[model samples]
Target chain A: MTVLGYLANGLVFSSIIVLGSIGLSLVYSIADFANFAHGDTMTIGAYTALVTFGAVGGLGGAVLGLPYGFFLALVVGIAVAAVVAVGTEKLIYEPLDVDSIGLLITSIGIAFIYRAVIQIRFGSDFTRFGIQSLRPIETLIPYGVRVTLHDVAIVASAVVLVAGLHVLLQYTDLGRKMRAMADNPDLARVSGIRTKRVKLWTWVIGAGLAGAGGVFLGLFNQLSPRMGFNLLLIIFAAVILGGIGSVYGAMAGGFLIGMITQLTPFFSNVVEALPIGQGWLATLLENLITLEYANAIAFVIMVVVLLVRPNGIAGEGAT
Target chain B: MSLLADPKAAFADLTRPERWVLGVSVAFMLFLLGALLTGALGPTYFLFLVGLAGMYALLSFGLNAQWGFTGLINFSVAAFFGIGAYGSALMTAESSPIAGGFNPLVGLVVALVVALVLALLIGIPTLRLRADYLAIASLGLAEVVRLVVLNERWLTNGSAGVRGIPSFFKGWPVLSTFPETMPGLRLVVIPGSPIILGTSFWEALLNVLLVLTFAGVTFLMLRRAHQSPWGRVLRTIRSDEDLARALGKNTYSFKMQSFILGSLIMALAGVFYTHLNLYVGPGDLDPITTFYAWVAVILGGSGSNRGALFGGIVIVTIREGTRFLNDFAIPIDPAPMRLLLIGIVIVAVMRYRPQGVLPPQRELIWPSAVDGGGTTETPDSGVREQKGGGGDE
Candidate 1:
């Protein structure tokens, strides 16, 4: 692939990776334990979209139009995520102390519980979007390459969501209080920030964003229980590689990882016939390995970042 | 230092009660197990479950070295376990084209070295990240490792995962002890034995031997280390990193040492896993297994070695026990329901007795007054703030 195509692919990949990581980054830097249930939230979001599409209802009769169904499904997905985010806090994670390792372990336990419950409700089948993995966009300004509507929406939505988050954090009262608490708990409390209310908003908003991301993901690709679970690593890698607490860093990291993923496939073609390329090397890798799974590429990126900067991207800014 | 000031001294007091509880529970479990053996489960079936619990418990103990001992909360225990199993299997498997190229002893040594190096390579960069970052990186690496195994077809045979491993130690002692017959469940033995040890005494024997050795090693090292100045410094680091550093200790180095040492042991555990099943694969390397090991460390008491053993056994036993109890206890399909039991156990463990069966106190004598609770040492402060922080950790 040429450099331009690579850049384009990176942008496409970045949109998804950043889209996923932003919600997690928002929650983690500002939130506490890493949420394992985040994956299921994505799964639930995809299912909401599926149901709205009336794909399951195809067995009977399709009543809801695609656009209307999509909008309604979006609302349902967001609502479900919001409720789960809040409910998990109240029912499972809240009662226990989770500031440190203990809370982290508890989070893992709770995450498993959430996963199990979801598994019971939704069996282990992959849910395919009625649309193709990369549905062609209207191509308002065609550059010879076809941009999938899914890709376009992801890029468009990601831009809006990130800009919205920045504005919310800078301009909103809730954002101010969240930063205050993040800086110093006692001070935030002493300042009468109503930390609880602010936190509730943070999770509802963060989870809602994740729900939207999930829908976006399903539009572009097949949905499975493993979708979010698999992407979580890359999302985290993006967050860390960019800078843990820095949302913008996550966006940058996401794109970088996405490009690397696509580029590996590009790199392999050259190796198959290139002079000086070891026959064994190409042959050894050809049968089992491909790096399109962004998470796999993310792992390599994470190792380098960690070795170079243990504090994560943005270093001290991560906290 | 005051005896209790030394966690080991305080821990010694608790070991007796610790042994008593696991002893009684395991004994009663064994009796019921015998009933399982003679009854519908028959001879070969019970051995399989016992072995699975033993191997899983052993892996958990290896993880406890980090979470239970040094307080790092390593989450990729299964990844390392898988690495060890696969590493050794690659060396000894009958199908391996590379097997005959080297001496068996050399092959085993090379495998161990390879696994050890892999652990260090993965651990060196990631282990210093602290808390969630470390957890994230390890989780990422585990997937990466699995992907590497999956993608490297020539090396790992791709998704088929290298098979036809020569069963290590299966020939030792009486072959019958391994159980010549699992009857209908024989299919489970080679792929991932689930029935034979579930019926046999051999599983219990292996647990006793391995756990005893682990216990011996743990007892001696923990005793001397807890008393030694370095040990005190290590504990200090766990309690408060700033305080330890203020006192002139390099908390970073201590953490690194503990992490590497603990991870190396986890690799050894992988070796045990491979030998048991005579196979290894991506499915075996799932993250859920890692989470279960964390559950073991918590149940064992985070800071105490004996607590780790008891907790590891209990965790494994509970996993199998619930399955066993569900055999006749519940009328519904149990596969989906089993995790619910795990979820409940975790919730209960988190709430009423977050400290676990063994409290974190140390003792001066072998038989001491206190019982060590796994996960007792750390304050619940972080978790209490989880909800306040939003949701996802």
Candidate 2:
């Protein structure tokens, strides 16, 4: 594929990653814990949509090659994911008396529970939505960019959700309270902000976005027991690269990381074409810059970022 | 000797909960012994279980050193374990892509050196950051290692895995042929169901001996280090890094040492596992193994060596018990059940008993300092108390 083809694919993949990173970053700031269950929360959303679509059926007409029922399934997926996160917080995280690291460990347990329950119900196999797959648009293929209408729909919906979030954060009362709590929970609570309520809302918004990301991811690829978990570290890399607590930074970081992951094959091709002498250096680059090492490349980038810029790219001050 | 004669007086120092734990452990061991004598559990399988427990104990020891003592959250436990397994497997397995037919002792050496280098590579970047950064980076390191193993077919044999691995005592003069040389024995323990001690049983006994050696040496080394001024410095770093730094301790260097030490122990467990299983695969490096060690350390009581050992045995029970349940009792799969059990244990432990079932309960001052003072100091005001609530930051 041409560079444009890879770029298009990156755009679609980045949309899902951006959706995931935003939730993780928000919770990290407001909830005050690196929730390991956030990825499983995405899995919850995807499976919920899978069951919803199977139950609801086509519901008549279609748009962008997806049935109306799929959209309904998407909404249901988001709602269920939000409800589950809230339930876990109320029943587990709230009553517990431990520091953030303790909560972090607890979150791993939560992640396992979510995944095990899913595996019990669904079995450890891959499945897809009832919606039929679509082919790349003919006009785009001629221009060396091949993306189906489904991919466009995913990107468009992500943009709409992200824009909605931007307006909410910049203008709305709840968003302001969330931002305030993210900045300093004690100050916000002292200033009459109901921190608990804000925290609950953060779970809702973060998990809700993650749910949408999960739905899009299932549509982009096949849904499996490990689908969300497999993507989790990459999402974490995105969140960290953007600064853990910053939502806007998460978007940029998600985009860059997602692009790099998808463009690894193209990068390898470029390396093969480069005339940078014939020695161990050339051989090393050729061996390392392959598609199989795509995720490894992202992880390496994350470690490097941790070393040079521990606070992340958009972090305001030293942590 | 007096305590053995008067059990009640021996138990006087232990708390009520500690006494209960001790009673339950004794009862459980007796039950297992009864089952073995009845010929219900095969001797070979029983010996294998012991070796598995010892291996897990070694893994837990490694994590205890890093997470328990030094407060470094190294999430790449499985990576070190996998590197150890792969390191040894590549050196000794017939199907190894690079080189094979090497001595198992050489494999052990290579595994430790590789683990040491990898530890330094990963620790140097994240140890300087906040505690959580180490957690994140180490997790990434695990994934990277797993991917490399899975993709680099030429180096690791990819998903096909390395097989034809010899036993741990492959090169030993007498031990190499000991299993074959020894005559098989059969005891009619239960009339029709005689307890058989065949070649496999002898081989398993040898594996158990090997693991015991590894775990025993690791335990002694850790005990000595953990009770010294050096371990006191690490505990201080765990509870309060600034305090240790203020006292002119180089916390970074101490953390690196702890990280490397723990990683080496985990690698040692891996080397043992490769010999025990006689094969190594990329799937062996799954993140589940890392969490298994985490569960072992936290549930066993962080910073407590005996607790880690207890936790390791408990983990093996949970792991093997689920398989046993699936085989005979229920039709349900064991994998999800094990995950659920692990999940519940973690959440319950955090919620109810965050200090764990057997938290460390002794002071860590230098033995010489206390001996020279010649004053009886209360053990109550020990490392756990100084650790305050929530052992980790």
Candidate 3:
């Protein structure tokens, strides 16, 4: 594969991570606790999309005269995830006032409950969107790199969603309130920013994006109960790698993580493709660093970044 | 230190009645578990469950040392445990395609060393971050460990996993022979013909002994450590890093020491777990294992070592006790339901009793009444603040 192919692939991977990490970062900033269940929420989102797609079958974009009904499914998926996030906050988080380690542990409990629920409900079966017949529109690049419609959709939607969030944070009153609350909730409350309302919106937007990210991830890969759970560590890696509270850091971290994770397998390939007379380099690479270690690469980066700058690239200082 | 400085002040805080209450409650719980383990059908099956609970208790003790005493959140419990399990198994597993076949004792030492190194590697960079970031970073580290276990086929035997690990007491004569002829064994030395006194019984007894040795040693060590000046320093660091630093304490080094100690204990527990099962698999070291230990810590009471043990026993009972339900052919699979219930229990514990079943006792041993200085130690301020910080939520 050409370098462009890898870049396109990286973008596709980054798009989903970006969506998830944005929510993760936002929640971290506003809630001041890591939502361990965020990844499971993404899984829930994907399943919600799957359920919606089935329920709204073969209806084929007739309502909006679009190419696919998956878009509508995506909306439902987001709503479902948002409801879950909001409901959890109302029931568990709000009442608990999760400012302590208690909240962090509670999130872990929620993660387990959510993941187990998905398992019990879905029977641990690997499901897919099953719209493979709607094949990706392949585009042949000058170097014979193949980019597809699905990849384009993922990258395009990610761009649009991130851009939309950027505008909201930059221009809107609610976004400003959210930022203020994240910066200093007491100050925001004293300043009459209605911190509670901002928190509500934070969950809404964060979970909604996570839902969409889940759908995109399902489209890109297999849909298992573990799909989101597996991605969760990487999502965290991205969030922390970018710095906990920064929106832009999440974006940059997501892209870097995605690219690194996607490209790590190619290290072995690069070694093999080298014109070295000795095979030891490739052999060593193959043995020491296989494709399965892709996830580890993200973590290595996260740890390195954390060691160098605990606040993250965009973070001002430790929270 | 003043002669009146009661180092075990926290332990001494228990009134006579309170001590009796705790003792009786613990005795009752242990009696039930012991009965279950020694029953007609208990020797083989229930022993496994009891053994597992012991391991969980040990893991919780380690966690209690970290989170309970030091206020460090370690999501990498499973990774450390796995490191211990795999480290020992690789050394002791009988002639595998992969792994170094070393002595089991050496394996245990190696595993502890590995865990200590790993804790240092992970803790050095991330411990300086806020609590939540440490949690996330540890979670990532665990995943990285899992990935290594999964991908490194030559070392970990890949997902196929290293198997047939020799039990810690593999060929001990007492374990393999009839207890009647057993030479001067303590259990046999007792003036009673125990009904379940046989080879199998001896094997189970030895396994139980191994777990007890580890658990007892861990509890004592942790209790001693927590009561020491070092433990007091850790508590201070947890409560207020800035204050601890201002006091000229190397807070980072203290925190690292706490982390490494806790991780070593966890790895030791893992070694016990491996030998008990007599097999090692990649599947054994998932996030769920870590979560289970966390649940134990939470349920028992986070900061208290005894609470950790109680929590571990309770959780293991629930988990293993529910297996009988499966035999009765329930409408739904009880496995996932058990987990769901555990999750609910965790949330309930967090929301209702964030301080846990037994709140951490104030560390200040107030100067004795006749000491002419009945004032609390200066460290009491930090302890008070630590307790106050538990539920600012």
Candidate 4:
């Protein structure tokens, strides 16, 4: 595939990653823990949409190859994911006396519980939505960019949601409160910002975005028990790359990580064509820069980022 | 040794909850022993369970050293374990892509050396950062290692896995052939059931012995380290890194040492597992194994060695018990059930007893330094301080 083709794919994938990373970063800042369950929350959203779409079916006309029912299912998925996160916070995380690290570990357990329950209900198999798959647009195919209408739908929806979020954060009362809480919870609490309520809102927005991401991800690929989990490390890399706790940073980080992951094969091809010296270095690059190592490449990039810029690309200077 | 010599005194030393744990553990062991004698469980399989328990204990010991003793969240326990397993398997297995048919001892040495190098590679970058950075980076790096093992067929045999692995005592003279040479015995433990002891049983006995040696040596070394000034420094670092540094101690080096030590122990567990199972595969490098060790260490009491041992046994029980339930009782799959149980255990432990079931109770001051100071009573103030202060990010 050409660079444009890879870039188009990256754009579609990055939409889902951006959705997932925003929630994770928001929760990390406000909740004060690296929630290992955030990915599973995405899984919950995906599976909920799967069941919802299965039950509701196509209601009428289709836009971008997805039925109106899918849009309905998407809303339900988002609501369910948000509700679950809030419930877990109230029932488990709120009463716990442990610190952020303890909450971090507890989140792992929550991740497992979310996954296990889904596995029990779904039987660990991969499935797709009732919507039919669409072929790449003919005009785009000729230009070496082969994104389908569904891909366009995903990206367009993501852009709308992100824009809505931007407006909410920048202009709305809840947004201001959330930003304040993320910056300094103690200060926000002292200033009568109602940190608990803001935190609940954060869970709602973060997990709702994650749920939407999960639904789009299922549309993009296929839904399995491990679909969200498999993508989790990449999402984390994005969050870390953008600077943990920064919402806008997560968006940029998600875009870059997603692009790098999809463009790995192209990079390897470029390496093979380049007139680099024919030695072990060349051979190693050729061997390591394959599709199989795409995720590994993202992980390696995350480690390097952690090494050089621990606070992330857009984060404030290191303490 | 002191506990064995003065049972009454040791019993008096235990907290009420610890006493309950001991009683339940003893009852459980006696029940298993009863089942063994009645031919309800196969001796070989029973011995294999013991070996698995020991292996998990070793893994827990490794995590305890890092997370418990030093407050370093090294999330790549399974990576080091996989490295050790693959390192040994690639050297000793007949189907190894690089080299094969080497002595098991050489495989052992190779596994440890490779683990050492990998530990240093992973530790150098993340150990200098915040505690959670190690957690995140190690997890990501572990995925990289798993991907490499899964994709690099020439180096690791890929998903087909290294096969035809010999036993740990493959070339140990009499021990190598002892399983085969031993005569089979049949004992009518019950009227209709005949308990048989054969070659497999002897082999399992040998494996149990091998695991016991590994766990025993690791236990001794950790005990010595945990009591020494080195361990005290680590504990101090765990509670308050600034305090340790203020006292002119290099916290980074201490963290690195603890990280390497824990990783080495995890690798040792993996080496034992490779021999015990006689196979190594990409699936073995699953993050589940890392979480299993984490669950074991945390459930057993973070800084307590005996708790780790107990936790290891409990893990085996939970692991095998779920399978047993699936086969004989419920038709539900054991996989999700196990995950659910682990999840509940973690949440419950954190909710009710975050310090674990058997938290380290005694102070960790050096014996010689305190002997002449006339402080005979070992107060657990350090442990209390750790519980309060260790979670500082």
Q: What DockQ does each candidate score versus the true complex, computed on alpha carbons?
A: 0.43, 0.74, 0.52, 0.76
Q: Considering summed lDDT, which 10 consecutive residues are worst modelled in model 4 chain B? A: B367-376
Please write out the lDDT profile of model 1 over residues A1-319, one tens digit for every residue. 4555556667876777776776776667666657656666676676776766664332332222234456566677778877888887777666775355566666666656655665566665677766434444445335534565556666777788778888887788877777776666678888888877777776787778778778877766677655766666777777777776666676777777767776676666655646645667666555324554445766877867876875566666432
Stretches off by above 4 angstroms in model 1 are A1-9, A52-66, A130-144, A267-294, A310-319, B1-27, B100-108, B170-230, B246-253, B318-344, B363-393
Q: What is candidate 2's lDDT per residue for A32-57, written digit by digit as tens?
A: 88889989999999999999999989
TM-scores of the candidates are 0.80, 0.95, 0.86, 0.95
The best-first sequence of candidates by DockQ reads: 4, 2, 3, 1
> Which tens-of-lDDT digit does each residue in B1-393 have in candidate 4?
547677887788668978999999999989998998888788899999999999999999999999989999988998999999999999999988998999999999999999999999999988987877778889999999999999999899899998899999999989999999999999886777888999999999999999999999999899889987799999999999999999999999999999999999999999999999999999999998999999999998998898899899989998999999999999778999889889998999999999998888653544323443333455544443465574444
Question: Between 1 and 3, whose TM-score is larger?
Answer: 3
Which should have the higher DockQ, number 2 or number 4? 4
Report how far residue B45 has shifted in candidate 1, in Å: 2.9
What TM value does model 3 have? Answer: 0.86
Q: Give the CA lDDT, 0 to 100, for residue B313 in model 2.
A: 91
- Ten consecutive residues with minimal summed lDDT in candidate 1 chain B? B363-372
What is the iRMSD of the candidate numbered 2?
Answer: 0.8
- Candidates' lDDT values, in order? 0.65, 0.91, 0.80, 0.91
Which residue pairs come into collision in candidate 3? Answer: A97-B393, B153-B158
